[model samples]
Each structure stands twice: as C-alpha cells, then as structure tokens.
Target: RARSRGRRCSVTGTPLLLCCYLAYLALGTSVFQALESSAARDSKEGSKSDNWTSLLNYTCLDRQALDRLIRDIIQRYKSGVIFLSNTTSMGRWELAGSFFFSISTITTIGYGNLSPQTMGARLFCIFFALLGIPLNLVLLNRLGRLMLFWVQRWALWLGGAQKNQARARWYAGSFALFSGLLLFFLLPPILFSSMEGWSYEEGFYYSFITLSTVGFGDYVIGMDPGRRYPVWYKNLVSMWILFGMAWLALIINLVISLLESSIVLCPCSRRNPCRT
Candidate 1:
C-alpha cells in the first residue's frame, strides 16, 4: 500500500513541477517585458531622430546617396567586414578566427559575431554542425566523467566511509560547483574586464552568457580589429569554453541528482502525511 501510494505521489509530482516551471517562465517574461519594452521604444525613436539630424546636416550628399551609403555600411557590418582596420592584417575569415568559429559552432554557442557569407560555406557549416554538435556532446560527456572520477576520488580521500559515501558525494559535488564558479565564472571575468576594457559587470555578463550557451553576441572576446591580440589568444579562449562547458554539464548533472533525491526522499506528499 505504501509503495503504491509513493508511486502515485511521484506520478502526480511531475505535473505539479511542470506547472511551477511554466509559471516561473511566465513571471520572467512579464518582468522582462515590463522592464525593457519602454526602453527599447525610446532607443528606436532616438536613433531615428539622430538619423534625421545627420541627414539634414550632411549637405555634401543627397538623401538618396546617404541612404545608399547607410545601406552599404549596414551590409558590411552584417558581413563582419566593417570592423576591420586598415592597420590590422587580421580578418574574420583568418585561419585562427575560423578555428574559433568552428569551436563556437560545435559547442552550439553561435555567437553571431562571424558567420559564413557564401552559400557554399553555409552549406558546409550545416553539414559540419550536424556531425560536430553530437561529437562535441560526446567529448563533453567524457570530460565530465573524468572530472567526476577525480571528484569522487577526492571525496574518498577525505575519509568518506562506505555508509556515508552518498553524503560525501554530495559534499564533493558542492565543492566542485564552488570551484567551477570561482574558476570559470569569477576569475575569467576579471581577466576579460582587464583585457577587453569592459566593466566588471559586462565581463561577468559575457562569461555567464557564453558558458550558458545563450550567446547573445553583444560582447565577444577577441573581436576588436583596432587592437592587436596574441596569436594564441583565441585558441586559449576556445579551450576555456570547451572545459567550462564540461564543468557546466557536471554541475547540471549534480543539480538534477539533488532534485531527484529530494523528490524521492520527501516525507510529505499527497499520499504520505507529514509527521510533526
């Protein structure tokens, strides 16, 4: 009777959790819309006003010519060629830059900072992604397992007995989460802020966005054409991204494990009365 009641409770819990998740999403959407919609509208109006003022001030070019020039500039920006400086020999399609793009693509980050402009390149990208994404996942899984093995070994070395191994594993997971947050989240932002000349908050935002694979593309590393970067800089960032993703996967697995354990161990359910 108890086992059947427990199973019933577990079955019902799924729907309850789903409802809660949906509600959370709705709340977030409402908050973001309330906060940003008006600001976005104002910004669009300001941009139009500025463009009109610029059109009026420029007597050398007619409106049609100015419009054509603007269109050309926008097209060049979209093609990722507008940022290239005359002094810099590096380009978006350089060998190092292409390698960075491949890493981002396989990791599913898709920063949108650079993309294949030609149809042939685009077709090749499509095929590459189909295979590369799954292969990246496999690599991440193996890296995560290797990390977990070391974490478990560290937990055992900390004197976790056979009976208390589960508790030790939980502690180890917590430690790993803390370490990952420090290494990937906290430390990297400081370096990015110093190197990219961004505010600390912006650096932190970029770090979180990139590692989470949200890839908003508002701020990408090593994209400034005006400044020279080390030849190995992009490669180093790519390695950081790959390892950070593996760490993120491990953290997600730990969280899911914790949630599952909590659900299973919960004493109070629809079928099971809470003991005070």
Candidate 2:
C-alpha cells in the first residue's frame, strides 16, 4: 500500500501527505465489534430521564416522535445488535468502550450513541458542526482519493469514468446533489416518522427546519417520556446532525464542480472565457 500510494502523488517529498496515508492505513479497521457491543449495553440501560443530556438532541421529534425512537432503540437493544455511542459511561471499561464511539461521533459517522445534552452544548454544536463538517469531508475525500489512487492507479475506479479535472468535478457535484436530497430531505423524515410517530410531512418539515438551524421549538426530542431514547441516543442524534452537515458540504462541492464544468463545456460569452 505504501509503494502504491507513493506512485499516486505527483509530489516526491511531501511528508504530511505521506503521514495522512499512513494514518489511513493504520486506522482503517480498528474495532467494529467492540463498538457494537458497547452501544448495545448502553441501549439496554437506556432511560426516560437521560434524554435532555444528549449530544445530538433536536426539537423536531417531540414526545410522540421520541417514543418511536425509544422503541427502535429498545427493539435493537433486545435484538442484541451492535450500535454506536460516544458518551463517557460509569467504569473504565465503559469509558474505554466510548473511545471509538467518540471518534465516530466527533467525525460524524454518528452510528448513533453519544451526543450533547445542554443548551450550551447544543449551541456549541452549531459552531462545531459548521467548522468540523467541512474538515471531515475534506479529510474523508483526501483519504478516499488517496486510497483509490493507491489501489486502482487511477483517480476514479468503478464509480464513473474519469474525465478532465473539470468534468470529474461536475460528476462529483451530481453525487453531491443526490446525496443532499437523500440526507436533508428523504432520510430525516423516514427516520423521524418511524421514531417519533410523526407524520412524514411533519418529520420532513422538522428536518428541514432543524438542519437549517432555525430551531422552532414547537417540537423537541425529549418532551415525551414514552418516545425519547436514553441520553446516549440524543447525544448520538446531535452527532448525526453534524455528520449530515458534512455530507451536505460534499454535495455543495459537487454542485459547484458541475456548474464549473457546464460553463466550460458551453460556448464562451464575452464575459466568460474557457481558459486553455
């Protein structure tokens, strides 16, 4: 992999890039099973009281919506499937269990366990989401592209045909638009409605509103004891929202690439010229 990676970079001596490559190679597959087991334990111990302390709580799910979330959590817990969490728990074992979970939540993979609870934390999340989201996407893209270049000896392998830099960018943008719709519009409603027992429209509306950071508190995550997940769940939801934002940034980049390509492909006007 190191030799393969070296051939991909045009630069002969950039140590930082090499370090990133090394990190990617090192961290790619650490502890999938452990994360799942720990999350399951947290779910089994979940409670009505813990909702407000979530790292990822939002105001859209309301009581009924929250109840549905709780059911899914409990169901998953009972089924003994592994989920993700980033919360610090009681013991050293539990604290250590949160190691990978914290990494995922902070980076926004948001397997859905640990999250923020207080208003101050949520407010901090808004800032963190904006800044951290782009960082994650850029890093993910670089890491992904590096891996592709290493293994395939090409920029893009199977996803699509490689084009000029501009065309490649446009292709990426299309992916962005598609993903954005799925994340911002489609997935939220499906997840919310299922968890909160909300109407699909209401779920979507809340998704849109909360994602936009409007925070119309007409509906909220923990208002219903019957519906809310444990504190861990809400915290994870916050992490998910941030991850959603990072995905959104990828979409934006894709859109910009597409527009740039379209302009390049078209005949030039007086105002804009295609640079050779």
Candidate 3:
C-alpha cells in the first residue's frame, strides 16, 4: 500500500516539477528581453546614424545610392559571395570546413555560420545527422563514464579509504567539476583570446556557450576571411569542441547524480518518497 501511494505521489509530482521549470524559463525570458531590448534598439539606431554620417562625409553617394549599395551588399552576403575575400583562396565548402560542419552537426552545436544550400546536400545532411547524432551521443556517454571512473580513482587516491563512500563521491564530483572548468572554461579562453583577438571575457563566454551546445553563432572560430589561418586550425578547434563537450557532459551527469543523492537523503524524502 505504501509503495503504491508513493508511486502515485511521484507521478503527480512530475507535472508540478514541469510547471516550475516552465515558469523558470518564462522568468528568464522576460528578464532578458527587458534588459536587452532597449539597448539593442539604441544600438541599431546609432549604427544607422553612423552609416549615414560616414556616407555623407566619405563618399559622393546620396541617400538613394547608399540604400541601393546597402541592398546589394546584403544580397551578396546572403548568397555567401561577400564572405569570400579577394586576398584569400580558401572557400567555405572546402574539406576542412566540411569536416568541422559535420562534427558540429552531430554534436548538436549547429553554429548557423555555414550550411548546405542545395536540396540534395540538405537531404544528405538530414540523413547524416539522423545517424551521426546518436552515434556521437553513444560515444560521449562512454567517454563520460571513462572520465567518471578516472575521477573516482583520483578521489580515492586523494581521500583514501578512511573517507566514507558518499564523501569520496562528493570529492570526485567536485574535482571533476573544477578540472573541467579549468581545462575547458578557463585555459582555452586565454588561447582563444590571443588567437581570435577577442577579449578574455568574450572568449570565456564563447567557450561556455559552445560547450553547452547553445551555439548562438555570435562568436564562431575560423570564420574571418581577411586574416589567413593555418589549415589545421578548424580541425584542431573541432577536436577541442568534442573533448570539451564530453567533459561538460560528464560534469552534468555528476551534478545530476549529486542532486538525486541529496534528494534521496533528505529528511522529508525519508518520510515521503515523492516530497520533491
């Protein structure tokens, strides 16, 4: 009877948890829009004013001509022609870029910087992703478990057998989280900042966003056409992204385990299995 009642409570609580999650998302959306919308509007207006002033000062073109020029540039940019540089011989559809795109697609980190334009290519992409995404997920799951095993071993070495199993697990989780932050979040940003000419903070933000698979497309690497990059650059970045994502997955799993264990140990949970 008790087990059946507990099961019922657990089933009922799921909807309540889902409602709370939706409400949290709503709160975040509202706060972000309120904070950013005004600044975005102001920036847009300022940009228009600056463009007009630059056109008037530096060129003989009138407003109508400027508008036409802007339209033409936009058209070319949308067609992916303007992305090619006169000085650079590299094209977006090259092998290295395609490899990077494939990795990004399978990892669900579609940066929206590059995409297939042809119908056939798009169809292929859909089929490729259908298979590759699951394969990538399976690989990451195994890698996460391997990483967790190593983390536990390190924890045991550090804390020794005198520590309780729970304490050892906590130590392992903490160590994994800190190590991942340092390797994926902190150290990589320094290199990115130097290589990309971005500020440290921007590099850190990009690392976090990319590893989280948000892929906002604001700060993609190796997209600049004016400057030449090494041929291996994109491949190296793809490798970094793969490892960082796996590390992040491991950290997330550790966090979820910790949360579940904490809930199981809660005093209210002992009295009511579905109290959460």
Candidate 4:
C-alpha cells in the first residue's frame, strides 16, 4: 500500500467533527423547536381558556360570586399561576430563548436565571450536554493550539534582536497578556454598553463575567421590554459571545505555554520541577 499522507485519523477527524456538529445542530433545533412550540401552545391555551372570561360573561352570578371569582383570578395571576401573553411578547421558549439556551449549554455557563421548565427539555439538556461538552473541549483545544502558534511567532519576533534572551521573552509575554486584555475586554464593552443600554461599568462586568465563564447568571442581553430588535441583533450577540470564548481560550493557552517555558529557563528548574 502507498504510504499514508498523515496520521490515520487526520483525514477522519475533520469530517467526523463536521458530522457530529451538524447532527447536534439539526437534532437540537428540532427538539428545542418542539419544546418551545408546545410551551407556546400551552400558554395560548391558558390565555384563551382563562376562568375569569367565563365568570365575567355569566349573567347569573351574584356580586359575592363575582368578587370571589375576581379574588381567585387575581391571586393566580399574582402568584404566577397563570401565564398570558399579548401579540408582542413572546413566550419563554421563543426564538431568542432557543438561541440563548444553545449558546449557554455549549459554553457551560448555565446562567441559572433561565432554563427549560419542561421535562423533555430537561432530559434533552442533560444528554445534549453529555455529547456536546466533549466536542466543545476538543474544538477549543485545537483552536487554542492554532492561536498559540501565531501568538508565539509574533512574540518571538517582537522580542528578537535583544542581548538578553530572558528579558526579551518576558517582554514578549507581557505584550501578549496586554494585547489579549485589550482585544477581549476593553473593546467589546464599548459596543455592549451602547447596544444593551447598560452603563460602561455594567457592560465591562458582563463582558468579563461572560468571557471568564464565571457566568454569575445576573446580567444578560436583549432583555428590554416593549422594544423590538431585528433578527440579526440577537444572533450577532450569540456569535460575539462564542468568538469571545475562543479568544479567551487562546489567552489561557498562551499564558500556560509562557509559564512552562519560564520554568524550563529558570536556573533552579534543572534541579527540581517545583523548586523556585
């Protein structure tokens, strides 16, 4: 047989990864669509079939009966015992929610403030995560390595033509760290502040929390009531978050590589791995 061009799985991984992702995308879209559709139907059904409507229409009911009916309905509405929506407001599992949930799951940020309330969605979330997390890890690791290669070349070039190698390397590390912060942190907050109508501080906090994957579950995007945004707006926000996570991975990988190199170069490293 002719010599193989590369590793046995080199050709296989790309197609396998593509297939896995497509399957997840198709399956997840179908499942979440179904779940959200059912929820919408239920909410509409409740709104259509509210008990108060019959009570208000019935002529035979006395004042006491009407008062009791109003009291019960008011209590239900206040306690979240009923969920009603007008034409403008979408249900919890509408398109925006579906997009948000998908991003949150893959990122493992799990912003606890919003989740699928239905059993089908809960079960799906569990298994989908089981399968998707590995795919995420592998892809992120590969991307991190690719980014690290470029970062090292840039750093080496920047720090070159120096008399002291160690000082040059240190300078390079500092450059990478500063650039990563500026790219991943400082710039995005400005756009976010304007788009989300948040103050600069809140925008920065949200950006930092999201990229770090801390996901305290406090702040989220596109929550403005009675405001209509274009379809591309929310979709773009989701894409931005995913891109930021990839960039964050690159930063972490760069830092780790720098640390390892520093340890190797340290005068004491030849004697002990942990000793300073």
Ranking by TM-score: 3, 1, 4, 2
Q: For residues 122-241, what per-residue lDDT tens digits would candidate 4 score against the true structure? A: 899999889887887787777667666777776677667665667777777677667767876787778777776778888889988887778887787765654565677676767667
* Clashing pairs for predicted structure model 3, backbone only: none
List TM-score per model, in order.
0.77, 0.36, 0.82, 0.56
Name model 1 segments beyond 4 Å from true.
Answer: 1-22, 48-72, 80-91, 160-171, 257-276
Q: Which of 2 and 4 is the better model by lDDT?
A: 4
**Top candidate by TM-score:** 3
Candidate 3, residues 10-115: lDDT per residue as tens digits? 6765675677679989999999999999999898898779867887778788888978987998887766665444523323777766877888789999986777
Misplaced by over 4 Å in model 2 are 1-155, 159-172, 228-232, 249-276
- Scanning candidate 4 in windows of ten residues, the lowest lDDT window is 1-10
**Candidate 4 residue pairs in clash (backbone atoms < 3 Å):** none
RMSD of 2: 19.0
RMSD of 1: 5.2
Off by over 4 Å in 3: 1-11, 56-72, 86-91, 159-170, 231-233, 255-276
Candidate 1 lDDT for residue 260: 61
Cα displacement (angstroms), candidate 2, residue 82, comes to 36
